[model samples]
Target: MKTRAITGFFFVVVMLGSFFAGAAVYSIFFGLLAIVCLQEFYGLLKKSGSSPNVATGLINGAYTYAAFAALFHWDVYPEAQTIHKLVFLLVPAMLAVFVQELYRNTDKPFQNIAYTFLGIIFTIVPFSFFHALGFVTNTGFSAHIPMGFLLMLWANDTGAYLVGRQFGRAKLFERHSPKKTWEGFIGGIIISAIAGYVLSIYFKELEWKQWVSMAIIISVIGTLGDLVESMFKRSINVKDSGGILPGHGGLLDRFDGLLLAAPMVFTYLYFIFN
Candidate 1:
């Protein structure tokens, strides 16, 4: 527990620094993290008795980093249409992987390649939304965007854990995540909403209604993200993705909720404001 707490603290500091630093810096930091996560994911795939080409893994990671950099640093697509184009890229890439699998004739080739792609998409795409959000600035609001989103996520997670430990009775999803309770989930939403309401006051561009809506979205979707990662772990028969961080397990373990939450928050901000 002490190790986990220390690691968690270190993670919070680094994330806070990255959030305040600006888009390019944050993108590079997270890009490296994405690469690490992809490597860990490939390890899991290998453990499943399927070997994805290491070069393919590198390609996937590069594509992900490029997609994010383009979305944020360049106007590759209209602001509203970026994600759709990103999705389009996936089809051709996955088709290429499928063709490669046919030639390899390895154990469970298709399923392994398919799930590996899914994991990457699931973990990386939503974060691109945050990267894009950093670009949607009203001058002074630049620093506020990432920090607000990070705080809201932190608040939600903290709220759920505290409340669940105290008064959790009914389970939320027993098979996917046994410790989560419906009560704690609701508590998390409420707490996060409160935090969002406070943040809205500072972010001049966003209305209170929009902020609260985002909070609700984050709480619910973030929980689902955790469950999704849990599902992956269960499938691979692992406790954590890696032991890179003493308490946090790996980049994936620490950011699972953010992976889902960031996209929802970004979409809400984009559609409502733009």
Candidate 2:
């Protein structure tokens, strides 16, 4: 517990600092995070006997994040057509992965292609939505959108852990996660809603209702994201995703909820504001 607390404190400081620092810090922070997560994911696949092309996948994952950054944030690619041109650079880059896999002539060549691309699709695509949250209004940047998501997500996690430990009786999903409880899930939603209410007071980009809605989405969908990652680890017969964070598992373990929830929240904001 002491190790977890210590590691978690620094983790929160760095994350919050990245948010307050500005867009450049935020981009570089998540960009490197995506790369590390993709590497960790591919590392898991390699341990599972699926030799994914780690280097090529990392390149594509970085490229994909770059493409999303260009599409959503960069002013140089202003037009819709320009966005396509900027983003399509990934197509050839992905194809290069396939060609390189063929030349390697390793066993299960197609499986390598599939898992390699899967790592990028799983890790990079979802993180790219962070860029969308900033420019939801078609102009200017608001860290609140992305940061709000993180705040609510943290609230849900803390709530669930505390509540679930105390009164958790029924298993939420015993197969993938034996400790998750429906009671804890409910508590997480309530806590996230309260966090949203508080956030609405400080960040008035949206109404209190909108922020609370985001909390519900995070509590529900983000829990699923955690389960999905647990399922991945269970399938691979591993305990933690990596040891980069000491007590906190790995990049993938820490950011699993964000991986799935960011895109949904961004889509919700896009429809709401656009």
Q: List, residue by residue over 40-127, the lDDT tens digit for candidate 1.
A: 7777767766676656655765676666566555442345454536745856765676677777856677676776676567655665
Model 1 ranges off by over 4 Å: 75-105, 137-141
Cα lDDT, model 2, residue 152: 94
Q: Scored by Cα lDDT, where does model 1 land?
A: 0.75
Clashing residue pairs in candidate 2, if any?
none
The model with the greatest lDDT is 2
Quick one: best TM-score, which candidate? 2
- Total clashing pairs for each candidate: 0, 0
Specify the poorest-scoring 10-residue window by lDDT in model 2.
72-81
lDDT for model 2, on a 0 to 1 scale? 0.88
Candidate 2 residue-wise lDDT, 1-274, digit = tens: 8998999999989988888887777888888998999999999998898999888888888988987776655553445556647677878998999789768968799999999988988889888886668778666667887888889999999999999999999999999999999999999999999999999999989999999999999889899999999999999999888999978899999889887888888888888887
